[model samples]
Target: MAVIENVHERVLSAPAPAVGRLIDRLGSDGDPLWPSPTWVPMRFDRPLGAGAVGGHGPVRYRVTAYEPGRRVEFTFDPKIGLRGTHTFELLERGPESCLLRHRLVATPVGAMRLLWPALIRSCHDTVLEHLLDNAERVVTGTVSRPVRYPLRARLAVAVESVRLRAVPVPEQAALLHAALPRPDLADAFSVRVPPGVSADPQAWADGIFRNPPPVVAALLRLRNALVTPLGIERGDSSAFDTVARTDREVLLGVDAAHLDFRADVLVEPDEDGTTVTLSTHATVRSRAGRAYLAVVRLFHPPVVKAMLRRAARVAVAPPGPGARPEVAVAHG
Candidate 1:
C-alpha cells in the first residue's frame, strides 16, 4: 500500500504544435517518440485516445484521458496490482519552445509493492528518459545527450528474451516453405526483433553464424570430427550455399552425401512487433544420415534456440560510444 510518483520532463527547443504532433503519433506505425527495438514499442488496440486499450509489454492499461497535442494518460489494469495513472503532458513555454513531461502516479499492491522499487522503477525511469530523448531528436533533429542503457537494464532485457518460444514455421517464411516443401525433419524458433534493430535476414543470419556460443562451437567441432571419419561432409559457413534470398528471408544449406539440410532465417512484421524466425529442414539421404540425425536431434533444438537468443540480445544492445552515429538515431 505504498504510492509512487515519478516524473521526467524535457524542454525541447521546438514549438508546442510540433511536439504535440509527435505525441499524437505515439503507438502508430511511424512513431517518432517512445524508444523501441531496445525496448518494446508502446501499442494500443485501436489508436491513441480515451478508451484505447494497450500498453507496452506485460503492463496493461487503457487510455483514460487524451488531448491530441497537449496530453494523454493511461490507467493501469488492477489485475496486475498497479493502481494509478501514467501520462504524457505537453506545456507551451514559448512560440519556439515547449516542455514535454511524463509522470507516473501509482500504488503498487502485493508482490509489486516489493518489485516496483527494486526492479520496475529503474527500468521505467530509463525508458521514460529515452522517450524524452526521442522527442528531442525527432523534433530538434538531435539529442544533446542520449541515455545509455545501464547494466541492470541490459540484464533485464536478456532475461526477457529467454522467454521467446518455438513456433510453427510461419507462412511468411517463403524461403523456408519453398526449400523444405516436404522434409524428414523440420523445426522453427523465433524472437521478436527489437524496434529500430535491422530486420535484415542477413544480419540475423550473421548473428547465428558469426560467433556462436562456446557450447555450440564445441558441438560443431565434434560434429565435424565424427562425420569426417564416416566420409560425410563437415559443416561450416563455407559448406552452406545460399539457395535463395529476399528482403525478408535467406535460405542457406548444404547438400551432403548423407543428407540435405537447409536453414531459413526470416523476418516478419505484424501489428505486435517484428519476429525473427530460424527454421531448420533436413532430409536423410543414406543410412549414415539416419544415425547422425538421431544424435544431432537431441541437441539441435537448444543450439538453435541459444543462437537465436544470442543474436537477439546482440541486436537490441545499446551501441557503445563511437560505435556508430546512426545507433542513437535509430533508438531515439
Candidate 2:
C-alpha cells in the first residue's frame, strides 16, 4: 500500500438533512444520504445510485465528530482493511435552503492502496460527482432534464406528506417557554426552609415574585434537561442553542416533540412559617416528516406535579438527594 491519499471537498446546494443523509450513506455501506434521493437524481445508475435498502455489506465503519445541522465526520473500518473519513457541513443559504460541503479523505497507509488503488479513487470520485449533481438539482428544483418514474414517484410521496401551519409570535413564544425541560431529571438537590416556615402555599407564591430573576433561570434550565432527552442535563442545554437564551425573553421556534417549561413561585407568611405555591406550564411535540405539527395530548399534569415537588426541595434548601418536611398537597 501507500501512505495517505488526497482530501476532496465538494460543495452542493441542498437542504442540510438531505446532504447529511447522503454523506452518511456514502461513508456507510450505502451511497449518498437518506432513504431515497427523490430531490436529486444521479447522472447515471452507478454505484452511488445502486444499493439495497439496508447498509452496503460486510464493510464496517465507526461514525464520530457529529455536529447536527452543522458537521458530521465518520471513519471507515480498518479491520476490514481500507479506511477513510468523510465530513458534511450544512450552511444555511436562505429560507428553506442550505449549502452542503462534503469532504472525503482516503488513507492507503495500510494495505488498501496496493490492494485496491484504482478501486478506491474511482469510488471516491464517483461519490463526489454524484453528490454534487444531486445537491444542485435538489436545491434549484431542477432534476435531470427527463424525469424518471421512481424519481417522480418519490417527489409525489414527499409532496403528499408535506403540511404547513402558521404559528403566531405569541403562540410561538408560549410554546418555547413551556417546552423548556425540567431539573430533577439532572441531579439531586437539597432544600431546607426555616423549621417554622409556614406550610401555607400562598406565602410561597408571593415570595417568588419578590425573590430574584436568576432563581427562575436556574430552575428552568435544570427542569428542562431532565424532562428532555436522557443525558440532556442543564449543562448540556447551556452548551449551545438547544434552547436560546435571549437578551429579552423571546420565542424562537424549537423542533416539535421538544419540551420547555415556565413556572411562577410565590410565598406568604403562615402561622407555622411560610407557604410556597408553584405553578408550571408545559409544551411538547414530535419532529418527523416535513416538520408538520404533531398534536400531542396526554396526562401531563401528573408528570408536572412530580417535577414541581422535586424543584421545591431544591429552591427552599441546599440541593441534595434528601427529603424535607412533608409537602402536603394542598392541591396537586
Per-model root-mean-square deviation over C-alphas: 3.5, 24.0
Pick the lDDT winner.
Answer: 1
- In model 1, what are the clashing residue pairs, if there are any? 37-194, 37-195
Best by TM-score: 1
Candidate 2 ranges beyond 4 A from true positions: 5-10, 13-55, 91-99, 143-332
Model 2 steric clash total: 43
lDDT of each: 0.81, 0.38
lDDT tens readout by residue for model 1, 1-332: 56898999999999999999999999887787866666777888897889999888888999999989999999999877799999999999999999999999999999898888788888888888778888887787777777777877777777753356899877887777776688888999988765666767776686676768888889889989888988788887764456789988988887888888889988876656578888998999999998888888999899989888877777676544323224311322
As a TM-score, model 1 comes out at 0.83
- Cα displacement (Å) at residue 136, model 1: 2.2
Q: Backbone clashes in each candidate structure, one number apiece?
A: 2, 43
Off by over 4 Å in 1: 159-163, 168-184, 193-203, 246-248, 319-332
Give candidate 2's TM-score: 0.31
